[model samples]
Target: MLGRMGRPGLIGLAARTAVVAGTATAVSGGIASHQANKANQAAEAQAWEAQQQQAAMNAAAAQAVAAQQAAAPAPQATAGGGSDLMAQLNQLAQLHAQGILSDEEFAAGKAKLLA
Candidate 1:
C-alpha cells in the first residue's frame, strides 16, 4: 500500500507540473502577441502622420507657385519696339488670309494697332 500511494503521488506531481508549464507558456505567448500588436499600431500611426505632413508640404509648394504666378508681370503681346506698326499690320493680314483670325478679329486688331 505504501508503494502504490507513493507512485500515485509522483504521477500527480508530474501532471501538476505539466499543467503549470502549459499555462505559463500560453500566458507568455498571449502577452508577446499583444505587445507586437501595440507596436504595429504605433508604427502605422507614425506612417499616417508622415503622410499627412508630406501632403501639407506639397500643398504649401503649390500655393507658393500660384502666388509667384500671380505676383509676376504678364508678357507683352509683341516682343520688339512698339513703333513697328506696319510689320504688325502685315502679320495680321497674313493671319487673316490663313483663316487663323476672323474678319471681325482682324478689323479689331487693326483698329487697336492704329489707336
Candidate 2:
C-alpha cells in the first residue's frame, strides 16, 4: 500500500482538509458581511424616506397657513365718525386700561386713528 500511495499521501490529505475548511470559513464570513451591509442600506433608505415625508408634511402645513392668511379678509378701514372707528378706539382704550396694550401701542393707535 505504501508503494502504491507514496510517502506524501498523508500530508496531501491534511493539506486538502485545511484548504477546504479555510475556504468554507472565508465564504461564510463574506456572506454574513454582505447581508449586514444590505440590512444597513435598507435601514438608511427607510430613515431617508421618513425624513422626506416629514419635510413634505411641514411644507404642506406652511403652505396651508400662508393660504389661510392670504384668503382672510383685511380689516376694513372706516372714515371719521363711523361706528367702526369709534368701536376700535374704545376697544384700544379698554385694552390699555387692562394693561394689554403698552403706552406706546396706545399712542400709536390713537395717532393712526386721528390720521
Candidate 3:
C-alpha cells in the first residue's frame, strides 16, 4: 500500500542522499590534491637535477678550452729586434697583474719569450 505521508518521506530521502554525495566528493578532492602536490615535488627535483647536469657540462667545456690553449704553441716573434716578443711579455705581465691571466698563462708566455 502507498504511504500516507509520501511527499515528506521523499524529501527526507533526497536530503540524506545529498549529504552522502557531498562527503564522497570532499574525500575525492582531498586525494586529488595530495596527488597534485606529489607531482609538483617530483617536477622540482627533476629541474634541480637538470640544472646540476648543465653546470657540470659548463665546467667540462671550460676545462677543454683551457687544455686546448695550453697545448697550442705561441706565435714566433719577428726577427727584426726582439721587440715584438718583449711587447707580448709586457702585455702578459700586465694581464697577470690585473688578475686576468692565471699563473699558468703567465708562466707559459714567459717560457715562450725565452725560447
Candidate 4:
C-alpha cells in the first residue's frame, strides 16, 4: 500500500495544495484591499473636516474685521481724523486685552483699522 500509486498520489496532493494556496491568496488580497479603502476614506474625512474648520475660522475673522470697522468713527470733514482712527485702535487693543477678542479677531480688527 505504501508503494502503490505513488506518482498519482503526489500529483493529486500538489493540485490540492495549489488550490488551497490560490484561495488563501485571493481572500487575503480582498481583505487587504478593503482595509486600504477604509483607511483612505478616513483620511479623506479628516481632511474635509479640517478644511471646513479653516473656512469657519476665515469667516469669523472677516466678521470680526467688519465689526471693528463698524465700531470705528467715520472720518470728519472739518479737521484731522487721525485721532479718530487712533481712538478706534486703542478701543480694539482694550477689547483684546480684556479677552473679549481672540487672536484671530484682534488681528482682523487691526488689519481693518490699518486699511
Selected candidate, larger lDDT, 1 vs 2: 2
Q: What is the lDDT of residue 6 in candidate 1?
A: 41
Assess the local accuracy of residue 12 in candidate 2 as a C-alpha lDDT between 0 and 100: 85
Off by over 4 Å in 2: 1-10, 75-115
In model 4, the clashing pairs are none
Q: How much is 21 displaced in model 4, in angstroms?
A: 0.7
Write the residue-wise lDDT of candidate 2 on 1-115 in tens digits: 3355556588788999999999999999999999999999999999999999988866665565447436755447745557867776786688668765568767886787667
Highest TM-score: give the candidate number.
4
Alpha-carbon deviation at 8 in model 4, angstroms? 6.9
The reply for model 4, stretches above 4 Å from the true place, is 1-8, 77-115
Candidate 3: give the clashing pairs: none
Model 3's alpha-carbon lDDT is: 0.77
- What digit string (tens of lDDT, one per residue) describes model 1 on residues 10-54? 678899999999999999999999999999999999999999998
Would you estimate the TM-scores of all the predictions? 0.59, 0.54, 0.56, 0.62
Question: Lowest-scoring 10 consecutive residues by lDDT in candidate 3?
Answer: 60-69
Superposed by TM-score, candidate 4 places the C-alpha of residue 93 at a distance from the truth, in angstroms, of 14
